[model samples]
Target chain A: MDVFAFFNLNELAFGLSKLPMFPYFDMAHYIISVMSLREQPGALCVSQRSPLACWFSSMLYCFGGAVLSALMLADAPVAPLSNTTNLLLATLMWYLVFYCPLDVVYSLASLLPLRLVLTAMKEVTRTWKVLSGVSQAGSKYSDALFVMVAVGWAKGAGGGLISNFEQLVRGVWKPETNELLKMSYPTKVTLLGAVVFSLQQCRYLPIQTHHLTFIYTLFTVTNKTRMMLLGSSSHPLSSLESFLYK
Target chain B: MDVFAFFNLNELAFGLSKLPMFPYFDMAHYIISVMSLREQPGALCVSQRSPLACWFSSMLYCFGGAVLSALMLADAPVAPLSNTTNLLLATLMWYLVFYCPLDVVYSLASLLPLRLVLTAMKEVTRTWKVLSGVSQAGSKYSDALFVMVAVGWAKGAGGGLISNFEQLVRGVWKPETNELLKMSYPTKVTLLGAVVFSLQQCRYLPIQTHHLTFIYTLFTVTNKTRMMLLGSSSHPLSSLESFLYK
Candidate 1:
């Protein structure tokens, strides 16, 4: 109900107009540059912040609001609509519904429930690390495991859409027909896209931005170089023994 | 190797007094929260000038930040040298290393690449809506469609940790073992928790806070009415066409 309610007002308008407006307004392009600038020395340290970052984030926020408002509007405004635009609009709006909300949740978690999110993140990593280590020894089904993770992630991304639709059809259509639609592949694909988009969005910063570039460069050059120099020698033999014995 | 490296850091810091002091400083927390709060309210508002809404959001942001910072520091100062603390700290620290950084990446996709996120969310919903409609009166596995969607979203939520770990481990560990760890049961549990938490938190405000009394009222009335009406229906079918046609 909430999902449909969010989409009902925002869906069409957000899909067609508000989503594409940013790129046209040059805000997206400018943000690309501004984010790059933010990483430069003294950019944030200066009293005046980088205008590009400010404008870009703000403009995107504004556009997001417009899309959201359109979603909330009770009546669809009469306008000439095109299929291409519909596709584009639908895509953009869908992404927001799936991913944007999670970002907020993540950010909030990082700020408030940091431990919980962090704990969850840790377990996921630990699981991967262990599995990857085992696979290195030529374990069977390693590839399958990898595929499973990837496919699983994709499915998760689309889950929200499916969940919401379940709710929506319960109200709109007969219960019996709703059951049949659930097994359809196309339906699964769309839901997967939404869930993936949202989850994917929750985890990363944009590339080409200054902050990301700086962090990537630092990790690639510094830690990578250090590891290269030390190789496996820096780790104690006692640690190696445990793995061997175990 | 990445896991080993992360573990090593946790191991090295064995005592409470040995923990890093900088991340726990009040000034740093305040500054980050203040800036984030200022940015987020404008970021979250459905309208550009929802000043009051922004103000309210700012408070929530502040509250969230404070709680997060405290949690971050909870195990900090490292608890005094103890096996349990070590395990807890190691687990917590390892988790953080594995997953937290991915948030930056996901944020990028949702914020800067807004169009992509929105589009994906919509497609997912469309697919879900159709499938849910079709699944009505379907077989047992048809109901699994919903489970699949739920699992898919969980993977999406946990994907950041998986991807980041994969990238980090690529240079160090063999790939096969890496895949194994990704699909392990612990990871599944972690994912399940994330989904539950996200759903619960999202619903809390709507169901518990805003409509606290409404839920209870509905619960009471629905239960009583259902019981009263249960035996009134002769065959549990109002129309012969519904049962006979099927």
Candidate 2:
């Protein structure tokens, strides 16, 4: 009997996708943007920064997923500031993360139990974006494998790809800081996933989207958990490589 | 015009209630259990602790809200170990928190961004438990305001109330560590909320359940945010009192 016969990957993927991950992903994106801006030299402090600049920087990061996917597919660039509720919530989250009195929100967010869930959910969000991007591109370019991969890759790692622009919007110029020079594990994994998805889309691989989702989710959750546990942002398997090679 | 006329708080409450908070709450409770066990002296470390004791202790915390509410309402003591999925997930979490090599899971959880979301969601879970407990008791004894309050209080602070028992299950009892003598701010707030909910049930207060939920959410979020920011587990308003009285 096939081991895979007992479990249905599609149903599992469907259930996982039903989770309320959008808000968590949105918040995670905003937090990353704010943190990235803060990390830049000569960037104004949260209190000193103009609200418009801060808001613009945040909008860029928070909506980068959608905007970049559209751009990758050569469609009209969807305006990032479309939803009022999303905008309001993002602004509130930005304020809380940076300006909450005594930095309480930041400290609470730093706790382990909460952090683990957010990180896990954020990965789930990335997987969803990558999958959607692949399908979206596939619909437009049915015969173009390269186009499908590129679109998915763009959707998955768009935030990083656009970091220079995001930073410029905040009046911080650091062209030296390119995502290409130091691609994050998530971005690399997304590229690989895009290729796999594109292959599957072109009938070169025999697997369902849900199957791919399950695989991606498993890989990411394990990788993230390992990264988080080791307290290292480096590749999750780097320790193994170091141990084996040394 | 009344400021309240501008908003449909009930709809807001309904929307908030729809959030996938159960899983987050369940995980938060399990994390707290493991943390509490770790904090005790003479207790075996996670790796050393018997799996039975760990599971039992975690189950007590994870299912405390539901079980305590049932008990308070004079219902049969619900079996905590009924759900296989929840049990399996709790076990996995327990292992991850305790036995993950290098304590990486714990470290990731210690981060600010993720922690804040978890803490906020946990408070939302608490507010939900209190409301449900109030209604559960109210149904059985419609005119019994005291019963409603008691049930709500138990549901809200049942984990603390049963902490001693939980520790005892781990073979590390500490009678001096009574919850009442050192009541947490959450417990105090829950007590106040219980009274308000009970009053509302008894028709002495003019407010809907959603209205109370809105108030509770606002109060807890602000209070927890303050506490987390100050890095003090003390009451959120204590600083205000010190400033005023000083």
Local distance difference test scores for all models: 0.29, 0.69
Give the alpha carbon lDDT tens digit for every residue of B1-246 in model 2: 133347755667657766665576767756655655555564445236355456556667766666677655545333333354666677777777767899987777767766666677677777877888888888888889888998999988787778876665555546786878777777778888888888988889987666767777888877887788888877855676579979
User: Model 1 - which docking category?
Assistant: incorrect
How many backbone clashes can be found in candidate 2?
A: 15
> Where in model 1 is the C-alpha error above 4 Å?
A1-20, A23-246, B1-172, B175-182, B204-246
Local accuracy of candidate 1 as per-residue lDDT tens digits, B209-246:
21222222233234323433562422222244247545
- The candidate maximizing TM-score is 2
Query: Per-residue lDDT tens digits of candidate 2, residues A1-246?
Result: 123356745566657656565576767756655554544565546336577777677666666766777754445555556677777777887787767899887777667877676667667677877878888877765646666776788787787767767777777655433454345677777877888878887889876666667777888878887888888877745666459546
**TM-score (all chains, Cα) for each model:** 0.16, 0.46
Candidate 1 has an fnat equal to 0.00
Write down the C-alpha DockQ for each prediction.
Answer: 0.01, 0.01
